[model samples]
Target: MPQPTPDRDDQARLFREVVLVLGGVFAVQKTDDETIRRVAAGLERVYRRARQNQRSTTSSQALAPHPAIAGLLRITEAEGDEP
Candidate 1:
């Protein structure tokens, strides 16, 4: 059986934890720009690979943003489009 989706509160908490962990990494004085760039590139690769896997295994609807995350995705996309 498929796993149940997390509730909105759990999703929000997870997002916040992700942000905090990433922020902490970047905040460290020893973290160099090159390291940050590599971290970002690795994350991009992971995201792309996961999306590809999902596409091969599930319908496009499975890739739709969970309702808890839809607004955040929209805001992030909007910010990403900004110069």
Candidate 2:
């Protein structure tokens, strides 16, 4: 006897549905305290490192003046006007 094979299209649809369900589970976990704690504990270091790099990049960009603004400042200073 031969075993029954699943339809390829049905298998693909099932895979998509599983991904969608997992996404929904994560979305729901965003507000659930127990799930949040479990996820945070598991990914705390990964999240912290990502956030740290993000903050550092944002702050450095914020602190650095744009090249056009710097050029304007230099022109004003050369003209003896305070920038």
Candidate 3:
């Protein structure tokens, strides 16, 4: 089995690699203004939640953690542009 990578740079690299492998066109696509702003807001919330999660000891490592995964997480959770 492959070892799980935990280093920040390594995780980022892995994330990029995974996205590249899985996302295709949307792996690096851009969206319109309102959609971009909403995504940015959701990302900001995720960052705040990440900070809080660090303080609170959240361990699931998944962005949303819980099954609900929330609207905020839904921003990042979009698999691709196509429905």
Candidate 4:
């Protein structure tokens, strides 16, 4: 099943949370443009790393087929049949 995508409200909420967290972490009461930019860069790095890890894990799992599928594959190979 296809997953539902986040709406603009969800995105806005996430942005607000990021800014709030960054401000708290940096000990700044107000978020400046430069600070927001820096925070955005850092967040992007973290997001990319997370996505990469997910992809790697998914690919590794895909490399290992179910036992039934593995058996069928083996049989097909033995019969010189293309799967």
- Per TM-score, the best of the predicted structures is 1
lDDT of each: 0.67, 0.59, 0.55, 0.65
Clashes of 2: 0
Residue-wise C-alpha lDDT for candidate 3, range 1-83, written one tens digit per residue: 85644654564565457445534533356545676567556655655564344554565775545665476467766754448
| Lowest lDDT 10-residue stretch of candidate 3 | 18-27
Q: lDDT per residue, candidate 4, 20-78, as tens digits?
A: 77678666566577877886887776555654444333343446768976997798688
- Cα lDDT for residue 1, candidate 4: 80
Q: Is candidate 2 or candidate 3 better by TM-score?
A: 3
- Tens digits of per-residue lDDT, candidate 1, 24-76, equal 96987668889888877766665556544443444456557688679978987
lDDT assessment of candidate 4: 0.65
Q: All candidates' TM-scores? A: 0.39, 0.29, 0.32, 0.33
Among these predicted structures, which one has the highest lDDT?
A: 1
- Kindly report which residue pairs in candidate 1 clash with one another: none
Superposed model 1: Cα runs more than 4 Å off: 1-20, 54-83
What is the full ranking by lDDT, best candidate first? 1, 4, 2, 3
